[model samples]
Target: MNKLMLILLALSLLCPAIVLAKGDVNLTAPAKDQALTKLLMTRHSVRAYSDKALTLDQLSNILWAAQGINASGKKRTTASARATYPLQIYVMVKNVTGVDPGIYLYDPQNNKLTPVPKGEKRTSVVPDAVKQDWVAKTPAVIMISYSKPEKDLGDKTLMFVSVEAGAVMQNVYLMCEALGLGTCAVGGYDAKAAKEFFLLKPGEEPVLMLPIGIPAPAEPAK
Candidate 1:
């Protein structure tokens, strides 16, 4: 062997991870430090937002992170119980560029937003979200809904659906943080009112609402 090979072998004997090809790459630390921990440490619920508008790309990425098909075939960002994939996402487009103002169903498989045609009412989503002024101010609100059959999840359907919805929102929160945006989970809204505002079907259930927007400069990055 050459001089470099001999040196590498000697170093590997002293420190097993010292081999040049298998250098001391603290894999676990790198993962948490670079990815998970950074996001977790910085992630905060942002209810206040600026008047800035979000581009279509930003909205698309956020939606994809929430429920897009990222993996091979139908696998998504989050784990679905029994692959039921019960969640449906609806975007209330208020200030997104290039998209009209309306509630659009997110078609994950096709990666497109199909506009949910509904008559414009006198009142907006503000009242449905218990009159949270921020909801009206934000550029967009992502509503996570469920319309799967109960038989897929048995009698504990609500429980599973709730758990799954939590995952979806967590994905949204992280994605928003990464995109320099802000969002908050609003469970205080009237579910019945949300159903009417979003025009839900008989069996479709509204689970959670995420009011997303450009956060006003309040807290500095940690």
Candidate 2:
């Protein structure tokens, strides 16, 4: 194990509350081949969302698909460079069944959400970050942040971290498609404003955001 892994292990052991046990919600086993292929073919960036609320099961599945632990020994659905796993997932909930409106951090290990301060601020920050009306109106927004990597790792760390973020986002896109939900991966945002809005720690930076919800009806073809 290298320095980063050792640091992560130490942190996990020290901060048990941040790590969670297996998810209690029962999830239907995913059909690997057929469903995945179909979803890929149908998936599209959806900017408009309906007022439908999301269920706990759907939220659980989406979070799992994003970066949940898939294997033993804390392995995740997405790969991390040297298992550094520098990404943090936060959900801004506007309308989720059984979940109060707020911002919550995804605890992948426990498969739960830990509430964060300023949940109502989600709307105010949306315009500052991306200035997109649809994004602020979505039922939920998943924000992916890059926690600073070790300085000794040098500049290559940014590239690896970005690739990891993309992998997680793709997983989310495919999962949303399978769930009959709509989402758009948003990269056009003010990074500095996001950092302050989300109350990110020093060195942590917001990388991407996904606005997700039930899709609005498609317009009739002309």
* Highest TM-score scorer: 1
lDDT of 2 by residue, 81-118 (tens): 88888999988888888888878889998989988876
**Per-residue lDDT over 147-200 for candidate 1, one digit per residue giving the tens place of the 0 to 100 score:** 875456788888888999999999999998888888889888998889878777
Question: Relative to the unseen true structure, what is the Cα RMSD of model 2?
Answer: 18.2
Q: Estimated TM-score per prediction?
A: 0.81, 0.79
Clashing pairs in 1: none
Residue-pair clashes per candidate: 0, 2
What's the lDDT for residue 212 in model 1?
87
lDDT of each: 0.83, 0.83
Name the regions of candidate 2 deviating beyond 4 angstroms. Answer: 1-33, 120-124, 150-152, 219-222
> What's the residue-level lDDT of 27 in candidate 1?
47
- 76, model 2: CA deviation in Å? 0.2
